[model samples]
Target: MGTSTRQLNIGFIGFGSFAQFLAKTMTKQGHLIRATSRSDYSAHLGDNFIRDMDEFMGLEHDVILICTSIVSVSEVVKSIPFHCLKKPTLFADVLSVKEHPRQLLLQEVPEDSDLVCTHPMFGPESGKDGWKGLNFMYERVRVRDEDICSSFLNIFEYEGCKMIEMTCEEHDRLAAQSQFVTHTIGRILSEMQLTNTQINTKGFEKLIQVKESAAKDSFDLYSGLFIHNRFAKQQMKNLESALERVKGLLEAKM
Candidate 1:
């Protein structure tokens, strides 16, 4: 099955900023999009927006993409009327943390429904120009329908994203070290209210960029990075210990 030829019916579970960003590209590729969220997006999504959860689940969709926040995954997944589903659909999530959704969907979604846990490392800000070379990690936890899953994944591949297949645990462990640490540092920089100077070095300029980027995202997202990923706590400790070590070294030199 050629991805270019197949037009998929992709339904979004949450139509927030991120989901809307993804929908733009999917729509451009000629895929049909239907969305249902806590907030009404009728103006943005037009007639495609279904406000009722049951009715939304009743639709025939190739993929039901979960776009809720990391903190709300449990509440949202529990509320979904899986019994209302017309058929066994491909259930995938675009959450930052993988293992949470991977486990939740496996437990909540219908036994026949396929599950794919994915995290598109780049968001709207980063991928605004294009998704070329952006990292997209995914774990096919319980996928049985290969064609639909492949076609869905092809959306990223079509945009030149660097796709990586990894286990949920591995992704969480690595993300805590890399992404969580980056966000943590960025938030700290933001708290300091750092600004550029006329004699700013390239490194300082980069730090300012990180601060600005982190400030743009909601604090809920930052907190979720810490709260959801088990490995994040250790990363936080590591960051603190490293800072203390650097301070001790400077004091000893004095």
Candidate 2:
């Protein structure tokens, strides 16, 4: 973590749920933030601009944190002035998938700044429970500034998250199994929509509880991950094969 939290002025690009949550968390840590707004070119998340991302990006900061959805990540990256970003600007994103956006960010960020792709496996809405199960997945490739990578890792580490590093491609391919498959299955569970009235039992109630929790995220986000991720498409094919094999086994059992 930066010993001088007061010196960490950050520019953020999006104003979604996780962005707002992370802004509050970083603000509590005493760092100033500027953000871009759909309305204004620059604005502060607090009084000066208060949720205007442009003002945040205009300020001098240690990092530019973009907490946008996976689909919007690249567009926001391209819109920002990469050349003007201060040296050692640690650019980090909290998007779910990595490879595509990570490549896009790398192309824009100069050698002086660091571009990191991170997937925070835990949501900020853990409330009182805190984040022990949460994992901060990251990658610090052969970029211009390695210290920026160190600084980025420090931010998540200080926030009580477990930091795991891998290449962006590896991260994306792996997430298909880790994140996409589970999410796809969870969506399947939610779509089933069976209730206790249909089958009165604690087991059924418990299943709904788990299923709803997994499916609690927006449908758009789910579609983005399941549809955009290349590995996810393959996994679904694998799933179809499994189901077919299982059906054959059941028929043979007869």
Candidate 3:
């Protein structure tokens, strides 16, 4: 990793909406951003978009950021021609689940390359205004080049993100407790198909926001959160048990 925040050739493997959002910030910070993905995003990326994977790898990016969904990450990484990588680069991910991507990248990427498993906890909606104080969690799994890693991290630091350095396992455990549970309840409320009523309390209004926010994301994303993170299955079970206990208390009152 580079010690200073110099302009880097950052290439994105999946140029989705989330990737585009991050690219906007990095570009503003003077990093050259280029991308290749399943779809043609040339119109959105302008000259920065490279349509061919072979060509994308040949660009010799200082950092290769993987922005694929949890479910598709394995497939996407497997399909990549790593041999085409022009040089040893830092490979980072912005997946919601940490350990899964961490394991995948370690197994797939070249031995010489570095790996950083990251999860930018906020998204396009929460970060629409700016990334100030937003949680940016990362684990420097295999960092041979500290200067380059620090430089890439400086991009988020420049945006006022609360940089959190923790192990991928710890991240998954905490995420299952907080993020997974929140999404589970949001999905439940969405299933109820909540609608605005004549009389709405502040708490109820917040629930509506949760439902709307969760609904805005694809079912694939929600499922990926639940499916990819091993800890999430236990969290789902806990949620069910807690709901049952609440129902029992209510039944006793009745």
Candidate 4:
């Protein structure tokens, strides 16, 4: 990551593992980080954890980032006290599915607040070393305060992320074919209980990595990709058809 260009007072809506992972980098970049969640994260966050939702909203924040799980986003967003916001802030999300959070933020956030729907494709595991070359997709759904919005975006850019500017609908469509499919295959491999043997091929080793990576994340995240993204169902069908086609070709030879 490059030198921090602009410092932002960023507040988080959820302080889960992903959120905490992001907080470490943001703090390293010299941005002020404060957070509020359903549970107390004082042990993890120290004084940065705010237990009261209303007080968290009332604080001065240039950006309020929603880092909750995809399944919990709707309920969490609906419960936010937007009335408590002291000033117009830039509201962004780090959900894997874009369109879902995009529509919800647009509907729920205050009219004065700006909205930027984003999905940083890499997770803590993928980005543990650095964010260089990792994809960071974003859509500026609503933005009146361009400076604050740009500052928030610069955080990712400074980290050498391959910035991708696209619409929410387009993101979901492409992600279903790419990310969701990868996760599905990884989960399938994990279910098969495959393990490394004394004589493992290079290809088998790679498959083991995929299985391990998918197993690290919660099932809720995997399910949310299917349930929230409209295009995911079709991708699932494609995977099943491909498997059957390959099976048929082998059977014909036999």
Q: Say which prediction, candidate 2 or candidate 3, comes out ahead on TM-score.
A: 3
Compared with the true structure, model 3 gives a TM-score of: 0.96
Q: Per-residue lDDT for 1-254 in model 3, tens only?
A: 11238898899999888999999989888899999988999898888888889988988799999999888999999999998987899999999999898988889999999999888989888999998899999999999999889889988888888999999999999999998888888899989989889999999999998888888888899899999999999999998999999999999999
- Candidate 3: stretches off by over 4 Å: 1-4
List runs of model 4 lying over 4 Å from the truth: 1-3
Q: Tell me the TM-score of each prediction against the true structure.
A: 0.97, 0.83, 0.96, 0.96
Write down the RMSD of all candidates, one decimal each.
1.5, 3.4, 2.0, 1.3
After the best TM-score superposition of candidate 2, give how far the Cα of residue 128 lies from its true spot, in angstroms.
Answer: 4.9
Model 1, 98-143: lDDT tens digits are 8888889989999999999999999888999989899999999888
What is the total number of backbone clashes in candidate 2? 15
Question: Sorted by TM-score, highest first, which candidate order results?
Answer: 1, 3, 4, 2
Candidate 2 residues 1-254, lDDT tens each? 22432336776677666776777766776667666656442333445344433445556777777777776666777777665544567778778888777777778877667677788887756633654546888876545655655655665666677778888778889989877877777777788875557655887677776677677788878887876677788988998899999999999999
Please estimate how well model 3 matches the true structure, expressed as its whole-model Cα lDDT: 0.91
| Candidate with more favorable, higher lDDT: 1 or 4 | 4
In angstroms, the error of model 3 at 107 is 0.5
Off by over 4 Å in 2: 1-7, 39-44, 48-56, 83-88, 142-148, 197-206
At residue 115, what lDDT does model 2 achieve?
75
Best by lDDT: 4
lDDT of 2 at 72: 66
